[model samples]
Target chain A: MSRPRVIARLDIKGPNLIKGVHLEGVRVVGDPNEYALQYYEEGADELLYIDAVASLYGRNNLTEVVHHTTKNIFIPLTVGGGIRSVKDVELLLKSGADKVAINTAAVQNESIISEVSRAFGNQCTVIQIDAKKKNDKTWEVYVDGGREKTGIDVLEWAQTACELGAGEILLTSIDQEGTRRGMDIELIDAVAKMVNIPVIASGGVGKIKHIKEAFINASADAVAVADLLHFKRAKLSEIHPYLISEGIQTRKVLGK
Target chain B: MTLNAKTISILDYGIGNLLSVQRALDAVGASWTMVKTPEEVKLSDKLILPGVGAFMHCANTLEAAGLNEAIIEHANSGKALLGICVGMQLLFDYGLEQGRCDGLGLISGYIDKIPDQQDDGSARKIPHIGWSELFLDEECPLFHNFSHIPAAYFVHSYMVIPEHSNHVIARCNYEGADITCGVQKENIFGLQFHPEKSAQAGLEILSNFDSRI
Candidate 1:
């Protein structure tokens, strides 16, 4: 098995990176490229970019962003939001993204998952799921960046996505997002168990303990940090060391 | 633009990440071009075949565009040909992907799924999507004088099984399974791991390739 990955998530709104709570009340953070480069230099394993309003606007403007970032950063780049078809995936891949995550469009048309898998191999196809806790045992799937409720069970959708050939799942908790607290360990645990593909736990990572819990308790293969990284609550460089201190096996780049 | 000195020609079959490859080449201070036409592929000296999807899609596109012949000719001419990931898989004789897909057959072997069970009968991920430490064969010229790293980035479900054991140059131990990740036969080289995304060490590998062959 590969080591657990630490990824930096940047939510893009037009040309700027933004921060949102519960996937709402958005505010600009800074230049996404700058933060991405910083995270890469700080020993981050991967970087992800999700267009904040691409699904609502039915357009993704991340090509230039990805193009500019990959110039120096030589890690895997996974882009999400408004990716509805194979053409969209090709555009992102051509723009230097190693993988792509689909959510809103996948909910509307489930076949896109398999389609992308066949067109670009399962390794590059990622299914992004936005979830909100429905109760203690279940979570509802939300779309359009957590704005629309699909009434779909989170566990079931994850399994379906996996069966449909999605290589990885980017599971974001709507309730815990941008909370500056801990992640929804129960939610992540449930979905991570439901899918065989790698699950990237996103939302509500404020400190090192939250990250450790997500990895150890939730069995998350990777954790995508946003608020914790963007708010300067912790340095991207320090998180991995803390994880290592706890005997967690995370990826380490050479001479970093 | 003049083809003054044989530049690094990357065969773009509309299925691979040519940009990142080009960027890696540029970073290594090697002049490269995204060769999309069969004519251009035939005219190239140092050719790179890149694929990043289902074997059937990539194989079909390569054959349909008549680029496969150009690639074979380039390889047969004793020119150095590098294949990346799915491109490397295509160098084999057959692929057990959806059905039995014909490959370029530059090397004898089959591409099969990594299997649900490892050597110890333990379960592992199907896609095998992450970085794994590389165990390279020192005699192989591909890694000569190259900087060793912690690991190279890997993301694939299938493993290449070359018919000739001598062709295997590097292997990674995954779940007690010593899977082949790099292979070489004279001027033809194949790497299952994506060096373009493996950080600086990866860039150095590309640089080494540029100067070596």
Candidate 2:
């Protein structure tokens, strides 16, 4: 078994990462650059910078954020939000981002995904899908920072994105976001079983066991956690050993 | 006659972020030129091949740009040639990344995907991102300042399985197999990981190359 990759997600609002109860009221957090380095030093596999307010602002500051993060941290960093065109993708890459994630833009224009993939290769392009459980049997895909309901099927979107050359899928469950009730494992399993590309399970990780479940149950390549790591409830050292015990491969945590 | 500074020509095949590779070279006072032409390759004292993206795309672009002949010519002259990441994989005979893509064939090996060593059979994560320690075979001049270092950035899944084991300079533990981290064969050098982004360890490796080349 290969080591499970750990990616820390930095949810940005304006210039800083913000944490809120659910997705309603938000409060200012610390400098994103500082948090990013902290994760990098902690030996995070990769860093994800998602502008949570990009759709609200109608613009993303990923270029500036990526430049700052890369200058200090040498790990692979991915930037997402408001990435609409190939030029937008190129700008993020030029700004020192290893990969650019597209969500709403990808759903709006499917061709953009193929074009970016063709131009930069699949590795540099990732498709993000925000999903919400709509009924007992179905989940609806959300767009525009998980604000608008696309009403598209999750399975269909995941397959389409992969076919269009999305290297990986960053799947975030709206119903599970900030709930800390653990990930929507069923949804993840459904998507993971469908897509050939690696699926990174985001939104709803509260404990160490939850991370293990993500690997064993959901079949996620990497788990993206926000509040758990940010709140210091789950340290890398603790998680590393726990996952290894459960027969999951993870990078050995160096002495802290 | 006093010798002037040697120009390290980096092969540009429309694949990599040359600026990052160039920046690393510049930091160590290595005079380099981003060469896209065959003439520039023949003119260089040292050569670097930096690549990103698919193997076929890069190989085709290099052939179209006449870099293949230039590289062979340069290597035949016994000038130092270093390949980074996919560029490193390109030094082999062929790559199994997507299809049976032909490589430069300077080394007798083929690039293949990292198999999932896990019993569950779900460990085929494409990009093996992040930093991992490199275990060296023998202390060589290429690692003068970076001996037995346990920290270096790695971001590839496909690796070269050399026909000759002596060509392997370094290996990193991943999944089941000892993944190839660095490869060296006389004047030809290849690294599966990015030395530029490997921080101090990377800098030291480049420094060693600077002094040796």
Clashing pairs in 2: A1-B117, A1-B118
Error of 1 at B61 (Å): 1.3
Candidate 1 chain B weakest ten by summed lDDT: B1-10
Tens digits of per-residue lDDT for model 2, B126-158: 556555667885566678755433467766657
| DockQ values, each candidate | 0.62, 0.35
Best by DockQ: 1
Tens digits of per-residue lDDT for model 1, A6-106 = 89999999889999999999999999989998888887888999998899999989999999999988889999989988999988988899999999999
i-RMS for every candidate (Å) is 1.5, 3.5
Total clashing residue pairs per candidate?
Answer: 0, 2
Q: Model 2: runs farther than 4 Å from truth?
A: A21-24, A56-58, A232-238, A245-247, B1-13, B22-46, B94-102, B110-136, B139-163, B170-181, B197-213
Model 1, which residues run further than 4 Å from truth? Answer: B1-6, B119-122
Query: Can you write out model 2's per-residue Cα lDDT over A25-94, one digit (the tens) per residue?
Result: 6667788888887886776767898888786666877788777667656567788988878888888887
Give the lDDT of residue A100 in candidate 2: 85
